[model samples]
Target: MSVLELARAEIRALVPYSSARMEAAGGATLLNANESAWMPFGDAGLGCHRYPDPQPAALVERLAALYGVRPAQLLVGRGSDEAIDLLVRAFCRAGEDAILVQPPTFGMYAVCAHVQNAAVVEVPLAADFTLDAGAVLAAVTPAVKLVFVCAPNNPTGAGVSLEAIDDLARRLAGRALLVVDEAYGEFADGASAATLLDRYEHLAVLRTLSKAWALAGARIGCLLADSEVVTLLRRILPPYPLPRPCVAAALEALSPAGQVAVRDRVEVVRAERARMVVGLGALPGVRAVLPSQANFLAVRFDDAGAAYRRLFQAGIVVRDVRRYPGLQDALRITVGAPEENDRVLAVLGDGA
Candidate 1:
């Protein structure tokens, strides 16, 4: 079954908005979209006065190359949040269709589904934080339109194996779209799920510069899917999803110099993560440091409330994930710079 068939009928039949920019391009024109003739202050050679391209072509090509996908298969959005929201809105009909997600993972998947008034089916991961393929496959009903699986999952800091993801995709074939949020793919040890895109037509991968690339404030993310799916999402996306400065920022982040800089940073984070796991594990009140393939470590403390206070007192803030299922005494800590990580270790040793 093609994914397009699973999409809402209204969306399949709807006509997209045609803005002035979409109508025409590439001419020495004035008075077309009606804007100021002067460039804004602090333009920085990116021409901030003019509205950004509805779809920045060059940036699209750069990202496609970086991810090993064709340009036509990519859809750029504000962030993974927007892509998640769009997938829910485009496929799941209110009060009818549903999406599946695993608990102790990213919350945005459920939040987006709830905002769209679609049912969210929770399939909690196994006790070890690994995917229970059989349970997930058994939960796929005809009403389920999308399934979200986060790799190197948030809060827990555990990764789902590619083989498991591949098996699940085959099982859900023609039934639902399998979305792999690879937000921390760069920090992982192996290849990305994007390598499986050509094999599974219903597969989609979400990527962002917020984590490894270190551009959280820019808020740029991408959806890598089949060309048909890309075309459908393009229609529903806002006419101008990226602004001039954001486009420039993303381009620079993907450049040769930027790539080198980010790689260096990734090395630092990875090294610090190892040091943290050992350091925090030996702490008095710490129980266990869950294995992590991402930039952060999820630590289970004997008394997380007290640990949180110690870190807070030292002007260090980390995520308290006690509310997440199976993580009552866990706190997620990002692997920061050497000095910062040392500070956190020092504070935790203060016996607060």
Candidate 2:
């Protein structure tokens, strides 16, 4: 049997939790699975009495429209976190299979692989924080099931080149899935990997409502992939993966009114990001300001621990990315509201 067939047979024989939604059928009387007798609290504006559509068709349609892809190409999950977990679970086999990651990138890629008992192969980005194509190509083996590239990457905040990603996809065409985690793609200057989805069947682009859309609390993320992949993932995902309230919130967040608000917020964040980069670059003990395509800037400090502590004490909660590979003594500061940015700048200026 082929490798994929062997993998599928192994997975198919493993019993997954039989969710109520999975067992229930579309019938007039729906009396199979026990649901709450009383009505749910609060006017969610959408009916919460009924279980949310297993995949939330309306949301998928709207997202497909927004991302310029077909509905069949999308899978909406709880968040990018869940998407990362699902991809690892669906593709990587325990102990035998592996996945490739670019370090100083998203932690969840490695985290999910670990949870699935999959080996993680690290391909450290170049000193300039661009894709080390040679390193990536060298790391992939037959055991590797997936390769995760975080564009406009987390912490480091640099977008990987489209040419590099395409090349990587081409190399792994039949061997592994190339997942481009575009969680921050909306903030980047170029068109997203969604535009290239048609060209590469092996390419999957992960998008989220958390960053640019300002809907972190809503907990909605989209995975754009080939329909066959989406179908397999859907079979494994939790039925009612999205709660009714979250689905409503996400739908509202993607509305025309919400889109305008998000655009305004994006502009504000982008402007703040630019301003903060310049201001932070001039601070005492500041080593270098990494160019950012995301809403946050990764700043190298002479004393990151001290700076992190000082910022924390001042009621600012920027992320300390010193633990990440190649990012020792670096702090990731998210661009906050105008006044908050000003406060952070003021605190940094004091040289504490």
> Which has the greatest TM-score?
1
- Give the Cα lDDT of each candidate: 0.90, 0.84
Cα lDDT tens digits, model 2, 202-290, are: 88999999888877988999899877667767767887789888888888889999999988888888898899988899889899999
Stretches of candidate 2 above 4 Å error? 1-7, 12-29, 43-45
lDDT by residue (14-99, candidate 1, tens digit) is 89988667876778865677778988788778877677787789999999999999999899989899899989999999999999
Error of 1 at 259 (Å): 0.9
TM-score of each: 0.98, 0.93
Q: What's the distance in Å from true for residue 85, model 2?
A: 1.4
Clashing pairs in 1: none
Residue 51, candidate 2: C-alpha displacement in angstroms: 1.5
Model 1 misplaced stretches (Cα beyond 4 Å): none
Model 1 lDDT, residue 123, Cα: 93
Output the lDDT of residue 89, model 2.
87
